[model samples]
Target chain A: MNTTSILDIKNLHAGVAGKAILKGISLTIGPGEVHAVMGPNGSGKSTLAAVLAGREGYDITAGEARYLGQDLLELDPEERARAGLFLAFQYPVEIPGVNSTYFLKSALNEQRKHRGLPELDAIEFLKLVKEKIKLLDLNEDLLKRAVNVGFSGGEKKRNEIFQMAVLDPTLAVLDETDSGLDIDALRVVSEGVNKLKAPGKAQLVITHYQRLLNHIVPDYVHVLMEGRIVRSGGKELALELEERGYDWISRELQLAA
Target chain B: MSAVAPATVRPVEPATEVDPWVQPFARLESGALFPQQPAWVFPLRKAGLARFAELGLPTLAHEDWRFTNVAPLKGLPFAPTLAAPTQRLADGELDARPFARLPGDRLVFLDGHFVPGLSRVGTASGGGVVTSLAAAFRTHAGLLERHLTRYAHGSANPFTALNDAYFTDGALIHVPAGRVIEHPVQLVFVASGEEEGRAQHVRNLILAEAGSQFTVVEHYLGRGTATTVTNAVTEVVAADQVVMDHLKFQDESRAAYHFAAVHADLGRASQVNLHSFALGSRVSRHNIHTALNGEGLECVLNGLYLTDGDQLADHYMVVEHAQPHTASHEYFNGILEGRSRGVFHGRILVRPGAQKTDAKQTNKNLLLSDDATVNTKPQLEIYADDVKCTHGATVGQLPPEQIFYLRSRGLPLETARRMLIHAFAGEIIDRVRCAPLREELDRLVWDRLEQDTQIQVGPHA
Candidate 1:
């Protein structure tokens, strides 16, 4: 039972185009932990995930985010990915002309290469992907197509989870993974996320509602309002927030200020 | 350059005086002799020679040759090579050319001389005859005389005129009516080494009568030569209810030059898909013209050009829909890098009686470097009513967001960019319906990027 910290974010202050959005955000996740981040609209939930993923056009005013004790801010986006940081995009881009299978294989090989491991052959890759394909309940035809091209809304989200199951990233930021999913897709995606839970790995679930937290059953739930975390409690905190909405947190934050 | 730039290009006038290289070619023509000829051949040669002498070289002032400046060729001593060069190559040395083998017939011409030892045309390919143009002229004189100079009147272009006057040898394929040749007739024209500053005049003609179907793959490969030029002319007569797929692949040396013209006459209900792949040469230009004489004809002109370094590739097409219910589609894509330049001029003309004509033209270019240039114009001139004609051109680079998306997946910067570029070229390569040829071309395009592109690829820490 090795319970070590997989990710540590300290006083992260980030924004876009010179306006600050994240104000002194501090969080930590231990191994095998699923921490839910519930915030209202424009609460900077996506901005936090984007900054952690090293997205461009995001000016980090001041922050110290670390993955496995390595400086995450110093690495480029691809470097960050190679170092085991995965971000499930809120709006996945449609990359034309690139085959899905080819792109995934390239990505997996890149990560393996960075770890000083031998590359996987085609047969070996196909065997692994065929098993992972079923975990997300995705159709085999999607893998043969271009990445995210002509895919339905639910399919793109499922694809994000499918990639997560394949790459086995040390830490993953699911930014609004439940935004556009129906109940069935939500259950499938949650099951896929739950299957990947293991020691030496963690997840930061970012969402605007508590619907996704119900299926995954996070160990802790934190309410973020106006660039700061004003409340954090056990899984029941999600139920309380869902019942009372984010108005309680905003009122409490006003009293504290 | 931006796409919104005004379309105002001042014409550049070339020296109207006689070009010095034309005199040497004329001198070589005087000493050369044909294998066999009828009385009409003499008049045809005289007309071609007289046109070359009068036209000299095309000037920039001419509307057709505006973007492509052949001024560099004026200085080269491109004397026609009458005698074959001594540089012999093995049969297996396809010179890095794709689709080196076919099931039916293959005609190999080295330095404009038919090389029987290197070719493999079995007797199994029966109804259709594939032989050297020289041999065809000596044997099937009537067949050669009927279609040789009837379509491509050399007076239109000087290069076509020169090719008609000095064509020592080439391939001639004739597929009989109602018969379909299962395999393609492959023609490989090699400019042997040490033919530096020399030129090769090659001619190819395909005569497919009614109900005939076949494919012709013509490859012009240049290697080991210091500087060479390939001036070729191909005339195709596609009779009624025929299907002919013609593909020309030009992979000359980076220091070489290539000038080719394809003049085709399609019959009623005939379909001709012409594909031109330009991958090499310092300066290359292709003139493609098709006359849809019969009603209900389909003429497809598709081209893909990948150029880098100081290379220049140009494609000019004019499709005339003379009869009603004719359709023509012209699509050309180019990828330019370094200081290379690409030119595409496509025109679709609908005659007075050519009602119900459906024509579409599109030219798209991808520039990898800031210095690379592309000038594309898709024009339509219609005089008939009840016709549909549309054309557009786009010159741009790979989208940066696509690169970011790929990079977010752990692909390195270089790999992501090279993949995108290959994908850009793949859009055109995939349209090739031939399965093996398409696969082989995909491999070649990837290999070119791996071996030629400046992007560095290796392990990243």
Candidate 2:
């Protein structure tokens, strides 16, 4: 239950292939704080999340990202996951022939082992997953099915959040999780996220609209345009952006430059 | 063919007393077993035996078996076992074996002969029919004559011809029209006795009448008391609107050479799901042929083979789409350890005018040792222009990421590796529709994989 900043990304410049997507982005997420990143399309929001998750193909040209005072960029994607960093992908990869329950159990156990905690057996893991899945309102049948195979878009997003809850990562990044969800599904998913938050965990909510922000209720809202953070403010910034639209922010950033 | 001069082969050096029938190109017991068979079947069996005698046992020089050498058969003194099994059903120790609790009729064959006392012949819901092939040959001769050897032609492969020529006893399952069997029918083939180099040829024919549905599981087990050779052939026919699920689990003793051929035919709108699990035998070869002969038919073929030491396992399959709107899918995965070798050759052929055919095939191999080897080939020949067909093959060791992921979870290195291996093989085994059979095969495969390090020498190995 450390109250220090869990993730500190300063002047993060990252990109995929040869093109840059994240340009000098600075962010600091303290323990228990929920930060919302709202932007238009091509705004580098996903790039920030991907870079934080340590996904390949994204070259961090220059930046320093510290998670609990340890260099985050030096770790692999799975290592980052074991180090309490979870990314809820917008379009989660469908891994056929892999059972969802088994996958989540292995993932959770890997994280626990990294933290010097004992791993749970199948029965114990099933019990824990049964509880978490209930909170997400997901069907138990999905746990028996292949991971995200043939699942609806909304169900895949809910499953991602369910996995986040099971893993209990310190820094959870939700990248456009609300894109494919209906209003009710969006509320349920956001509620699942809110219920998992505690004094020791933080979340970075990445979205394209203020609708999700209204449900998740982020403590800080940042406006990203053209691969950089153009504006940062409290929760009201989301409402202002919803009213003013992203075109104004793009224009203003252009004008300021 | 005048015995063909041993086909330019020498008698195995220091060979044991060889049976006269073991000679290459020697016709033995021809036209003897089919005295009462139909006129057409009598000649068919004779022609098959003649062809088998002419070709002799397939050697590595043969195109189809280029990678599989039959040199071990040279040393075998394979005389047919004609005696009936004396063991009773209750005394057969099946209760303590895997797949014992499977819900269905059980037919046990010992030493190439059906043991009625050791079989449980009844329907799962008191509705289906399970009887011996010999009985079926008398009572349902018309049905047997019409479908037996219809799909698996003896002229196509020499081993298949030999099986057709010599097979004596096998299970015959017939599901009545509109009847759905709740449980699978288990056909267990066991090799027992102190006879060395004994050969057992088993032939099974399963017919699901129009609109009927059922499952059949065939198990080949070796008693390990003596070296044996098992040549088995199964022909399954699903009539219009019918469905059939078949699983073949081969856990014969390592001292046995197992060869099996399965031919499946599907009528209009019929469906068939077939799975093959190979975890035993010194050298095992499986030939699977599926013919979608009617419109809207579907067939799925999935297999898993795990081998170690010098053991060799080969799976060859062909799916022929003869009508439009038919679909076929084939998936095979193998795990090889030690110096074991595995081979997969699968082909999907869509005939002309079969426009809506959809076929997908994938064969993947995971080699755990540097000396372990795999040969995989997936061939698709489509004549229809508007058809969808795809084939893929991959051969490699376990993904390091997956192994490391499991190990990082505090599982011991060996346990983690074993789990990953099991998971790889489980991908195909899990496709088995019969739960009991699937579980049994899974356990047997795991046990065999574990024994690779402990037991290194066997007749088959």
Candidate 3:
């Protein structure tokens, strides 16, 4: 397609608390490309997401990750976020006493300030958030409450997507964002993701089922097994793996090892 | 011996030389000048005065008073309330006190005397009673005599003794059986007068009958140039299936000294929540004692203190689990800025037969300056082998990572640091059940924290 490459990861080996979880994983994402990562549990898909986000309590044993021609591992978590890299956590942290709208605005302004853009005050930010809230069908009352303090599982997942829409990151990593969504919410979240896709943006969707891929329609499918990507193919590969199940892939990886 | 009289004992002593107040059995004979108070009240006041004269003021030698010095009290001469109120309070100033907007029964006292003109009494829709203690003594003498000074006796505290002797006007709140009061009853005590070194002996008695529920808020404020001392005592009795929420807000003037004691007697299946907010005063001390006298009782003691500018505030609490299947919790947090100091000592005791008791205590302090200091001690003494008890204390500044996270979001350094401080204090403020009071106190404390110019936002990486 002759698209410009935005992210290049070569042999990323990382772990949490000194125990390796990502074992020599290689991937490259070009502009306007959608890559769906499907794997069984404990397959290092989340580990790869965490490593890319620069979360604390993780050590990079060996890896080379370049985002927008800059070393990604040298930045802190917030710094990575400011650099247009966003990770939608599988389990979002519930920060009590911090208002939802206030937190989101602060995060948005931080990214804006990093890019030398004028900051948006409360009124302007609220107007911006209101436009995006309609895309996700979220209630206006959710913004008044504390950040995910008493939200249901599905609501929290939806809220994460809503945050992604507001931040508008260049490289968005969805770490199992479909784990707890219902059918209706799944559609809403998928539509939100679709509306945000631009010619200069890329997305890495980490999931365990083929149900979510039916809506987002990834360009490439990668099968991660035992901390490494064992197979890479076209979008049809996800459907074949979904129908055949993960057992055959497990055996194939074992035989290859 | 007569020719060379001994230097030590030369003259004969007078029989009447002994101070009348010093004698143990001396009766306080009311002269004509004594107000025509109730006759039955004289005996209790006389006994309290005699005990106070015998014990005198607390000194540094006493274990409880070791950390606090009463030397400033020695130079002043304090007498009972006989003079008029010197500092006249403005209408706006008085209306700004906490709970002024709430529509409930209120009792106002100025210099230990009831000011009926300023007091407002609403219809008791909850089948309860809210009145002055002096008036209640004449109206419901039997109930007043039986419950007043009952729990606080033998407390071994000199301030309690002084309060018992000289308390002229106080609050008498009685919630009837099977009744729940929708609005909270507020007791406002304002210290104003030119009588420097004058003392206000205040007492409050709250009795909740079986299956009753109510809330009480005690507010202390000062408004004069004179230095006043308030020695206040409150006794709460919660019967079976009753619930009581008691909140004490101490915002006296910086030139004032305050001493308060609260004793709660809880019965079976009763719950008592005691909260204290200490913000002002040169020296303030609060002693809260919760006695779980019946089984299936729950007592919670939550407190917060903010001290600055050489002020000192101390909170000492004791939770006694005397019966089985009772639960008690104590949480006290403090923010010390400038050269101010804070102290928290929480002791929990479980008796031998008090099995299945769940007791937890935590004391946390946030020091905003290098010169600020805090002394926290959490003590647990459990004799019951089957009881579960835990205690912990933490003393540190704001988390640097949290502060930096806010600062990186384009907020100014001062705004970011204040936000963290507010968040740290918010942990406790959020627990306050009263919404309006909680929000007001939050704003007040935030304003107080901002006066410090040397507070550092991000100290660690």
> What is each predicted model's overall lDDT from 0 to 1?
0.83, 0.79, 0.79
User: What's the distance in Å from true for residue A104, model 2?
Assistant: 3.4
Query: How accurate locally is residue B381 in candidate 3, as Cα lDDT from 0 to 100?
Result: 78
Candidate 3 lDDT over B166-233, as tens digits, reads: 77678888888989887778899988846678788788999999989877889898877677889899
Task: For each candidate, report what fraction of the true interface contacts it reproduces.
Answer: 0.62, 0.05, 0.09
DockQ, all candidates in order:
0.61, 0.10, 0.11
- Give the TM-score of each candidate: 0.88, 0.74, 0.72
Question: Taking the tens digit of each residue's C-alpha lDDT, what string does model 1 give over A50-69?
Answer: 88887778888887888788
Task: Assign candidate 2 its CAPRI class.
Answer: incorrect
**lDDT-superior candidate, 1 or 3:** 1
Q: Write the per-residue lDDT of candidate 1 for residues B133-179, one digit (tens) a residue.
A: 88887778899887897889833677888777677788888888987
Clashing pairs in 3: none
